[model samples]
Target chain A: MNLKRLESILDDLEGFSDPNIRYEQYVTPSYVAARMLHTISLSNHIEGKMIVDLGTGPGILAIGSALLGAHYVVGVDIDSSVFQIALSNLADLDELFVGQPPIDFVESDVTKCVLKPKSFDVAIFNPPFGTKGNSGIDVSFIKAALDLTKVAVYSLHKSSTRSFIVKKGEQLGAKVEVLGQFSYDLPATYARHSKAVKAIDVDLLRFSHR
Target chain B: MKLLTHNMLTSRCLKGVTNGYPLKIVANEVKTENVDYNSEFIARVIPKVDWKVLSSTASDFGVSLPEEPPADIESNEDMLRKVHHALLEIEITQGDLICPETGRKFPIKQGIPNMLCNEDEVK
Candidate 1:
């Protein structure tokens, strides 16, 4: 599907009902998600590939991957509460994906989940940027994602951590690239929100194991 | 959870457990549906699957498959169809995935498995 079409589809997805600040459950703008998935699709990495979305809240990326022809897609998260909404999102679009791989969601910690390592072809996620008390948690998500995929990982991190993330990826022996940057206009969904909406700079980074 | 997903999960998250694979399945509900067949994709992914786990799991749902990928898997349309069905079609709507080692139970409800362990149980 075209970028505009993809974004429109993602726009209809449900967001977290009770947003948890501890997990940094910020909404991923449909426009930004479309751009990230579109870029990965352009690179020819998604089709017929086993794809996993770490910290997949609302299942936007996971649902989008199945819609785009992924052979299999699994979305893992610590929050079971969001599974119903995420599953409902898939059910809402079930008619469109009658022939696609089964899209499954698992409830578990992103870094500590028991999913097999080096099993998936690609990993995509908008991991928490660790702005909360859980400092350095994004690194754990990145680490788990890199360990899960055989070829590459696509993730979003705060632009402020670009250098640290780059260095971390290098230290983990993966080739890292800054695909693009986005300004996340996060809705004041949790207690931390001072305004109705806040804008945070996010960088889309691709970590390739080559 | 589909058998394909169950084939990849383990209890390694539990403290003191290593290689907690081939999690035992205890299903309270199982659902099946037909999806468009894609042999090419199925053929490519077969190698990555744990065949022994998959074959045994298939039987639990009354869908029998070979103990391993058939020797002629690439061209075996009959086997591919069964593989596709077992992997993607058979969903364990409610169940428990027990670790072979610690026997720790991870509950699966409404088709989603809760694989999270308590902080104290985390290694």
Candidate 2:
């Protein structure tokens, strides 16, 4: 499917039914997901490739990978409650493709989950940026992805963390590229937000492990 | 849990469980469903899969895979079909995925494997 049609379909995907504050769960905008997929497709066709979507809330990235012709897609999330919603979303998109790759959802923590080393071609995630203590959780996801994949990682993070991510990528001996920046509209789900939507700048960073 | 997921999972997170890989499958229930076969996909995934674990797990689920994956998997259509059936078509409806090292049991219900562990189990 073309990028435009894919974006529309992804737009219809259900986000958090009930957002979690501690996990900092926020739905990744379909446009951003589409844009990243399009950009990645320029260098990587995605067809017949193994893709893993870390923290796959409702399987948006995972389903998107399947649609892009990834051979096998695994969506891992700590929460199991969202799997049903994700499966339903996949069902809706399954009709569009003749033989989409098998998509699997694993209820596991991204940091602790043991995937074969270099098992996947690409690891994609929109990891939490909030600092748990001294460090942000996005670094952990990047580290895990680097450990798990052979090719590259596509991740979403707050634009402010660009330098930290780049430094971490260098430390891990990977090349980091800022693919694109987009405004993320954080809908006021919590009581603290005075506005209906709080917009913030976020960057999509791609780390190539050669 | 599909064998495809099983092939990548390990229980190494448990304390002192080095090489806690290829979790043993103790399947209480198994189901087979038709999934569209893609030869290219199967061929591509074969190299990534742990063939020994896949073969053993498939046998436990009554889906037979060859003892060894074909050397030239890309051109081996028959082997690709078998791998496809083993990975995508068969699902473990209910079971306990036992850790090889710690012997901890992760439950599978309605085809979803709960790999979460207690705080104490986290290491």
TM-score between candidate 1 and the true structure = 0.96
lDDT of 2: 0.82
Q: Could you tell me which 10 consecutive residues in candidate 2 chain B have the lowest summed lDDT?
A: B33-42
In the range B1-123, model 2's lDDT, one tens digit per residue, is 678888988888787788789888888998786777888767777877888888988887677877888678788788788888898878888988898887889998877788887768878
Candidate 1 positional error at A162, Å: 0.6
Those runs of model 2 whose alpha carbons end farther than 4 Å from true positions after fitting are A99-101, A131-135, A189-194
For model 2, how does the per-residue alpha-carbon lDDT over A159-203 read when each residue is reduced to its tens digit? 877898899888999999998999978767532457888787889
The collision pairs in model 2 are none
How far residue A187's Cα lies from its native spot in candidate 1, in Å, is 3.3
Cα shift from native, residue B24, model 2 (Å): 1.2
Query: Clash pairs of candidate 1?
Result: none
Tell me how far the alpha carbon of residue A66 in candidate 1 is from the true structure, in angstroms, after superposition.
Answer: 0.8
Candidate 2, true inter-chain contacts retained? 0.68
Candidate 1 off by > 4 Å: A99-101, A188-196
